[model samples]
Target: MQAKEIREVSCVGAGVIGYSWALYFAMKDLSVTVYDINEESLQLAKKRIHESLETLIKNNVLTKEKSEELEKSIIYTLSMEEAVRNAQLIVESGPENYDIKRQMVEEMEKYTSIETIIVSSTSGLLITEICKNAKHPERFIGAHPYNPPHLIPLVEITKGDKTSEVVVEVAKEFYTLIGKEPIVLKKEALGFICNRIQMALYREVCDLVTRGVCTIEDADKAVTYGPGLRWGIMGPSLVFQLGGGQYGIAGALKHMGPSANMWLADMADFKKIPDEFAMIAQEGVNEELKNRSAEIGNDNASLAEYRDKMLIELLKLHHKL
Candidate 1:
């Protein structure tokens, strides 16, 4: 079915990610049903959704009345049958266990229509493995969204070995309709794109700290005040192209290729974390948190609010909002 033909979307597992997905669909005026087994989790998801809507209103992204109307479009339920009933799309954000996700797909297939597209929010697990037990594996695909799906625009649409090309296109259209930048992977890979890049950078950061090259706070400051700013505007390849001065990427590669290759060869290549490194990493994080706690008061909710606000303003500057 075309994305425009999809009116109802089901969100299985109403945690932070699932709830954010539901909120995004609701804001787009699509009907959303969120299903969770735990009553407390459902309540918490409702509360977070309300708070998120208020944040959007305060940021001038939506009017209060419109936000209220959108909120009403989301229906919370415990019954899997009710959740998938009439749902054109189902986004699964349950636990990350392979067995659990496979089982969930098997169960969802029993109720959902044969044509309904089911996507998983898994960060690293292979979509082909996750859908192995699916009744209609052709209808299964991976739609991994970055955290806070309501705010983030990038959604990685990955295909399993058995996923149909038509299903991938439909999923891409669906995410685009809901105001997301959907990137389709030609082939499936663990961690998709964003997380893979994230881990590459994180690995270097950890290595640097372990070697006493810089403190965690200093490393963070370097990112926030340096390349991170440029990365926010454009990707590294483009940045390198510009860094080439009048010659562009060709000249830059010719001049720096040897040094870059040397650095790459010398970079950390550890397959497993050492116990000492783990302890140091934990201590460094604690120290950084303690330092920030003095000024931020250690309230996670407040920190998250601050983060979302900053992200919204950045999006606005980039003409994304």
Candidate 2:
């Protein structure tokens, strides 16, 4: 019954996502080997991980000795075989090119054992298509993490048509054991689950900006001060359920439907604006970042700190619950 067999983790690309993955795995006390073809990029990746660990330590998120131990737990390698040979979980973070993904997965399958789970950190590529040419398509699945994965908790676990359900369950257990929140999708789509939801909200925000109903700053404030806080505690469904009171969604809809329709209408008008919304949106984003850069950075730092502590607390509470 112990299909939660992940022990060593290997990341094939030592870029931002790869480096972040290495940090997450190593922080979980699993040995991680990160591979990159270019030696300079590999070194930079290692440096970035160390720097982040240092930040964690300085912020009291991780103790100095603990950070050192985690740094020692990770190894950087150029040889793909050496990186993945003993790894039970291998994350492919290469560029989003079909040919490259095919070649890498093919080469990886040649060396990785049958039990090893191949996870794609791809953002857009379909899971089924990526494994179309993989030798062990049964073992290949999508374990897409949010940006700056070391800090974010959500890992969207998706499977292709050929992927085995057992593999998905095992991946979920492995992620849970490593202190991540895994949301499993019953089917695979273009953006999977999280990204699709993210883009839907993003499109609306874009439209809101184009229509001049609110400035770019107003849109972000709408989220950070509203759903963002609630979403931090619970997902959208649960949060809305709580907002619904005892009558559930039906009751809430009766009261809120008119406002929702108005908001949707305003959002729809955004699509009619000439593509000039692109420049406005970009400018708005940049301006918001510039204005809140320092505050946002500090907030992120504190949030990461709180996340680590909260995960520990929740794990302890889970037994009692």
Candidate 3:
């Protein structure tokens, strides 16, 4: 069935991701049932969700009227059977433990229809390995979203080994219908797309400090102010393509190839170094956050409001933002 026809969705686990998923689905006008085993945690999840919606409204990102409607559309439950019984799409976000997921899937399979689409929000675990014995493997897919789901727009939609092309297509359409920038994974690989790239950069940052080339603060500033702005617009490859007549690696090969290769080799050899760099990186991050935590929290509300206002201007400027 098409995603537009899906009217109800069930979210398993009432943790951070679960609450975010509930708000996202409810905002789309879909009835959502959020289930969890812990009664107290579930109450906290409900309270957090309402407060988040209020924050969005205060920021002018979500309307108060719409927020009320979304609250009404959501229902909290502790019964797994009740949550999945009528849901057309089930998103599992339970603990990362493999045994826990296996048990949850085992129970859900008995209740959900064969046609229901089951998506896991796991970051790196192999879905094929986890759901190897699931009843309907074709309907199982990975719908991983980044942290703070309300702010991040990217969603990685990956299909397991036995997942059909139709399942991938439907998942993409489902996410897009809710205004997510979902990308379909051609096939499963370790860390998928974003995380792998993230790790690569992280490795280099570690190496830089290990070799005494720069302090952790310097590396952080380089990425946050330098490549990060361009990355916000496009990937490294596309960014280079627009850089004067040079196109990606070809241009870099002619201009900065020697330096790039040197760094690559340094990174390879630097991995065997001592733990000083790791300590520095960790301390640097902690110190920076410690200095800014209060300021960040103080302005988070107003910043979110400004963000929404700018979004309206952005859409007008681009005519499609």
Please list the C-alpha lDDT of all candidates, in the order they appear. 0.88, 0.80, 0.79
Clashing pairs in 3: none
C-alpha-based local distance difference test score of model 2: 0.80
Q: Write the per-residue lDDT of candidate 2 for residues 15-77, one digit (tens) a residue.
A: 989999999888877879999989998999989898888767765578999988888878888
* Candidate achieving higher TM-score, 1 or 3: 1
In angstroms, give how far residue 102 of model 1 lies from its true place: 2.3
Where model 3 places Cα greater than 4 Å from the true spot, the runs are 246-249, 268-278, 289-321
- Per-residue alpha-carbon lDDT of candidate 3 for residues 92-172, written as tens digits (9 for 90 to 100): 999887888888889889999998999999887888876887988889888899865655668998887898788888889
Off by over 4 Å in 1: 289-299
Single out the weakest 10-residue window by summed lDDT for candidate 1: 293-302
Candidate 2 lands at a TM-score of 0.87
List model 1 lDDT by residue over 63-148, tens digit each.
99998888877899999999996899999999999998988898799899998999999887888899987779999988889889
lDDT: worst 10-residue window of model 2? 312-321
How many steric clashes between backbone atoms does each model show?
0, 0, 0
**TM-score for each of the candidates:** 0.93, 0.87, 0.86
